[model samples]
Target: MEGIAIKLNKNISLSLLALIFFLIGLFSIYTEVFSGIDRMILDYKFRHLQQEDSNKKIVLVSIDEKSLSYFNSNGMYWPWPREFYQIVTDYFHESGAELIVYDILFDTPDFDRRNLSGTMSDRRFLQSLKRSNNAILAFKSTENEDPAVDLSMNNEPLIEHYNIKNDPPYKEPHLLTSKPLDKFAKAATGLGNTVMSPDEDGLIRSIHLFDSLAYKGFVPTLSMAAFLELQPDTVSLEWTSSGLRIGDQNIPLQDNGDYLINWYEKGGVRNGTFPYYSFQAIVKSAIQKMRNPDAEVSVPPSVLEDKIIIVGASAAGLGDIKSTPISSLEPFPGMEIQATILNNLIGNNFITQPPTWIAILILLLISIGIPFVIAYSRPGKGAAAIISILFAIIGIGLALFTYERIWFSTGLYLIMATIAYSGSAAYKYFAEEKQKKEIRSAFGQYVQPEFVEQLIAQPNLLKLGGQKKRLTVLFSDIAGFTSISEEKAPEELVSFLNEYLGTMTDIIFKHSGTVDKYIGDAVMAFWGAPIDQDNHAELACRSTLKMMQKVKELAPQDTNIHSRFGIATGDMIVGNIGSYNRFNYTVLGDTVNLAARLEAANKKFGSNTMIAEKTYEDVKDVFYGRQLDFLVVKGKTKPVRVYELMGEKSDPDTEELEKIISTYQKGLDFYLNREWDKAMNRFQEVLSLKPEDGPSETYIERCKKFKEEPPPKDWDGVFHLKTK
Candidate 1:
């Protein structure tokens, strides 16, 4: 009962520890205690795992170093005249481009009094914007209110038509507004905010689709503006707590109303993720077309047709570079970030983070499940299981991101599992050490040192309960102990018995046997208990042989002191037996009784050691012995075949013993067949070979008595012993 209570308490303690870890994980997740590490893991997944290909419909037009150099040589410096944009817009409008989005801000009108061509340049750019209804211009929005800027300038007539309806009136505060100059905003098809918000880590992982301005209402991002313009008709926009739904497409959003951007590999310039073309290349193509109608252009019509082109500056000096999840060492361009957002919106390939409940549930499972598994398992096996589960979680997260575009919180799960394992392992180590100390204190003097160690390593073996096991039990007693005790004085006899018993006990322990007890002149021991031994029968047999040899060496030259052994192998109950206050680690069953009876029967056969049939069968290959008789003891009804154990097969006199055993078996066979004369002849031959062969001499007398009596007709050959 006490052991059961201890076991239950241990399990409860492990569960409580697991619960503590689970609560810690839950707190960490909700509080974002390890968000930085979580983000790093997310970035690692994006960088290494398989990525989705960039949308081909989106194209990038970079005003790179080459274009800047070409224009500078031609006397056109930075912020080139608006006529340059007019030329590119006219080329794209004539080439059948679907949408042309400029990520550049044009908040002020060109007014160069010295050139006198600035007004003309502005007029030409305005005319191109009105001509190409697909063009969208960029503007800026800020949280800081600017008193110098007229706030009423946000109420432009052209920006009002793209108002997205919010049924519930999104209560999130809107930012202060800025817009392109009135003439340019009125001439362009639409205007969008170009402001980008990066994460706390300074990486642009998400973008706001719509910014609710202070008074101008909701303003769409540059990407969202182009997307809205591509719609076949004016669609209703509904905003809920989840996200905005435009027409039939549902866009998932974070709590702050930002859509997570699924990044693509960093493929730069032409022949990369998205097809790239230089500003000089587009301008040169337009010039070539104006010069000759049949001239081959740099960017063919087919490449630009039906494509959404994003025109933005990419020169290093422009300071448009931003860090992104996929951009590790390389500086990602702001133009490419805009292009990526637009691509995600167009394709509906945004990465969605599942609900907080899902992450919490995963964290809870890992924290609780890992400790429970580790608590019941061996140390080495438990460590292996923990490592395997961690990898499986990572693989599952990566697989979901790669194929489903779903982001699972795997980093938190790993942290929770690691904590659970660490706590469980430390507890197990200390608990085992405590168990070892208790085992040494309790069983040190009772059992051998090695047996105590075995119990310590596997403490469950010390439970106060019996379990049925196939075991080999040994009973050894001194032959004629009453007479030997009568001959020696009390003090001398005590010393002699202690020496004999101690030697025999040492031999039993050496063979990994547990000494059940020591009766005055007898020793009870067993194998296959406290520790499992598959070769229990062989071990018991070997111990008995060594004990017999040691007795001869320990006895004085004048005195005859011989030890006889009996061994039986069968199912027996082995465990602690008796009241709670006092108990003995021992085995009890019919097998044990048979072994004790065999020890007493050894005196009848005049043999040093005897073993039951089952024991002989188990060690037949290693031991050399001969069958004695199918004798039923006084209290037993059923008969059991017994064998007198001889030396091992490796003994020097094994050949001579084999010949004697062969003769003895033949004599017994004749006796069982009722051939009295032939049985006497075979027994006499065995006795001649071995002068003191006990079973042979006894069998010869039995044959003689049977010949004189001419026993009953239905008589079987089984012999019954009258004494134990």
Candidate 2:
């Protein structure tokens, strides 16, 4: 998880971020069982319509080129000859046809409009009308609400010859009437409306099956046509939570009665749903079928065989495009489209809703699995491929389920997971990369190159917040730097100090310690963070000894370079420290203060190196050092022992070590016993052996003081410093 966090910070992106939030939101969802199942009601309805059209077909007496040329030069559109209707009906009657349907509306009679009141051509429709008892005629709406008079061919009649004295509105089912063709509609097979749903762009979207039943219980228009034709041996119904169902088929109905005729593209019905060969060609085909009963004809029998065919133009100018699931184009008439829908449903090309538990399970699988894929995937091409693979798995799964009568949340899963993985990866990558840059930029300037790498490798060493760490602190000051500065002008002094301090700091960093701070000629430093160093004490002590030697080497080379070095070891807060607005990567504690005291204490002796008791304890086995007297430095309660680390203190002959130990112990014993004379003698001997020893010299002065006063009986060897 940590590694992933680092990676995400480095590689975060906007798309991925959106995906992450999206997935989070998705996961939070408590999906309900069968939540989206209501939509399947629509699926059942379309299938029901298709089933209705399965046994119906259309017969056209197309007014083709041959018929139109003979009738008039105008060739179609307006004034269809009354006698032409006679020939078409006569042809269907001569053959063994079940029903004859007129796709054309005889709304405004051409003869009547033309004032041909006694025309011979107009009188022929009377014979055709009487002979064709199984004929269905079409009527179009004129958007007129007035029901005053009836208009017929050319000019004369305003009366109903079909005797509508006791007939209902649907008997002739005029668009103006509200009621279905009750007793009158029963005289014909079925009545259908030409209404279509519109697309988003205002083109007709669907053909809403408007069945002219005495009541709406007759089901949809196409379904009514099928029921009228088949008149199934037994009608049965099944019920679902959605609504009533006829057998296995469900008819979708909205609260206000809609077929859910969502539009598909117009070309969707080229498989036998195109317009029949005009009104003229149909007459010729019928004549041929009549003249040669035993011969194969140009017209296929299935063309008119049990197929509920609604003849309506779905073309652009005819205004039949509708919005649908497949696209936003104008769809076919609601009746024809319903026919197609029913067929498809009856053929089992439909999807259904799964149980609620199944939906919940699917969502859980996606949410849990996708995140893991994102987390485990590597970066670059491999990550991209994994993301793609996961996407395909989800997508294919959804598609398969869809085909198998189920709706899966493919889009949601893809969008969510892609965003999540991408977001986490992008964020982790960018964050870590930024930290690395900050590490390089921050420490790179003041630290050694290798140390900079180490800091970057583990930036936790230098935390954004301060933390406590045990570090070895070192402080060094120029020996008499003020006096040395006095010998030189201020400008030369500043330049000299910069050159010297800069070089010393370089050595400090080379030993893997941070240059904590600089105070005039004194330099403070520590080890053990910004990176851990368990051997930090050893490293600091070694650095201090080297610094002292280097100072000596520089002292004579340039009188301005001699410096006193201080080394201390203990617990100290060694990370960024300060107010939020201003902080420093520095160490502070009693041990740190002791280190400063040690630097100043170097002045009491002519020596260049001074180490506190803790530091000495760490390196005494490796370095030669002399223990000094205890003193309670300022800012500390317990008196601390100090030592002068001379050089590498490997094994020495017992003779030399014992002699030094003997004299040192005797002096301490005499001093504690308050024997001023004996203590002075031992101190003088110790100083004689090690002439430049600060501890022995200081002890001698203490002995002289005790001899002069010789008063206190409870006195012990405890010294206090005025400066910390």
Candidate 3:
């Protein structure tokens, strides 16, 4: 029984612990509490797994420090004349460039004070765009509404040229837009928005391919615009459960409708991954070509031929530097991000994540599985298992990310697994193992060796510290023990006490009771603690009767040796009591005290065994016992009804004892009613039937005394014993 209880408790505790960790895992994933750790891990993977080469079709024209310095030295400050861009545009066009994408937002008109006709520079740039027929200008999408910007003049042309079919729109509409002046926007082959919103950590990881406009329909991104310009027959865009599909290619999208970018090796004018040309170098090439038409230039025409040219600033002062997964210490330029997006689109390469349900399923498996592994296995084996699980999760996550471009939330799984293992291990150590030690040390001698082993196996049977419980306590003492000790020699007395205590203890143990302590010739014991027993009262009463019978059988023929016992059942505090250096596992409270008082009260009634009413009530169906008195013993204010336990109902003498008990109860009733004559007659009848009955004789004497001096009218037949 104790083993079953302990096992149940352990199972419940471990299950609850696992459930708590599972909930924590779910909450952490939903809230992204450990996203920073995940991001750091992703950055590490990016750094280690970066490609050695970049896309060959994309060329970067960087307006870097050298270009800015050279232009500044040549009397061209920042924001050089639009005619300078016209020269570069014509050079790329003549070189047979597939597409020229400007990541610079030319929202405001170009006004050059040095030019005689300020509008002439804008006209020249527009003419170059018209002649090239491959220029895609950048625009900005804003949340703030701008009523001042006219929408009627070129709205139809812009929408007709750039709008793609958005079947089942995936993103919210951008209510407003900021684009180049009417002249430039109308003259450009196409327009794309360059809106790059970073994550909360300020790292740009994804971009939206198409954003719906309030009055202008859908506008594609700069990369999307370049793709469309190169493939004009593509039209429809559709949103699916996993991602978006444009023409024949499918692009993965996050839950927020943003496409994750699969970055290549960092490339710019400073690096050689992509074909990088400085803005000043391109301008010099154009100027040299105009000078002689066949002049040799710093940048050859073959470099730009059939390649997508991305024009944007790379200088730190331009405020286009962005933190990407590849590098944060040295950031990627915004122009490079656009080029990377274009490369991904062209190559059909993008990073994807598994569905939320898949992550939750994995979390649930680890959260529930790891705890059981830790709980059932040995400590070393459990630790090994946990480490193996951790490695497996990390390995699988890295493999998927490397080969399949699939990112799984492995950090969340690791957190859940670590917490489950540590929590289960800690509970086993502190709650189960510690309890076993306590039970072994406390009950080693009080209980049988086999019982102690059982207790150790199921330590949950005992609550080591003080706890209130309903238990039956017993106290026994040898009647006239002091006189017997005085008559015998020291050795004889020791031998007699040893025999008597040993016999009584054996009887108590036979009934599964704990011998609490022995005080000289007296023994104290209890049932129903350290373990639970439904019939604790019956066990205590049976032990009391057996001990009394054993005392009679063990005594010498001439010597009169008798033992008195008192049993009680009630709520009492049972635990290890006394100082730390020396403590006894004992029972305390009024229940224990009452049992001791009842043992002493046996002398007054001349009864061998007495039990409190609570104990009698619990065992009445099995044991034959009669009411003794409403006793308020020494140091107590409340009266308790006590009974003298005669024998079990199955005993041969039970019938005779019941007849005597009936007569005695009748006399007690009459005596309490103040009918002295009637009570005396009943008592005489009881003595006639059993001449040696001490209670009947005592009641007769009580009736005579009460006849002479009647008890007070308020008296309730309660007997108060004045001595301990």
Q: How large is the C-alpha RMSD of every model relative to the true structure?
A: 6.9, 10.8, 15.4
Query: Candidate 2, residues 330-358: lDDT per residue as tens digits?
Result: 24333345444444334434334445456
**TM-score of each model, paired residue for residue:** 0.71, 0.56, 0.62
By summed lDDT, the worst window of 10 consecutive residues in model 1 runs over 167-176
lDDT, candidate 2, residue 395? 59
- Candidates' lDDT values, in order? 0.82, 0.55, 0.81
Over the full model, what C-alpha lDDT does candidate 2 score relative to the true structure?
0.55
Total clashing pairs for each candidate? 0, 68, 0
Poorest lDDT segment (10 consecutive residues) of candidate 3: 160-169
- 54: Cα error in model 1, Å: 7.4
Against the true structure, candidate 3 has what lDDT?
0.81
After superposing candidate 3, which stretches have Cα over 4 Å from the reference? 1-9, 52-54, 144-172, 175-177, 446-724
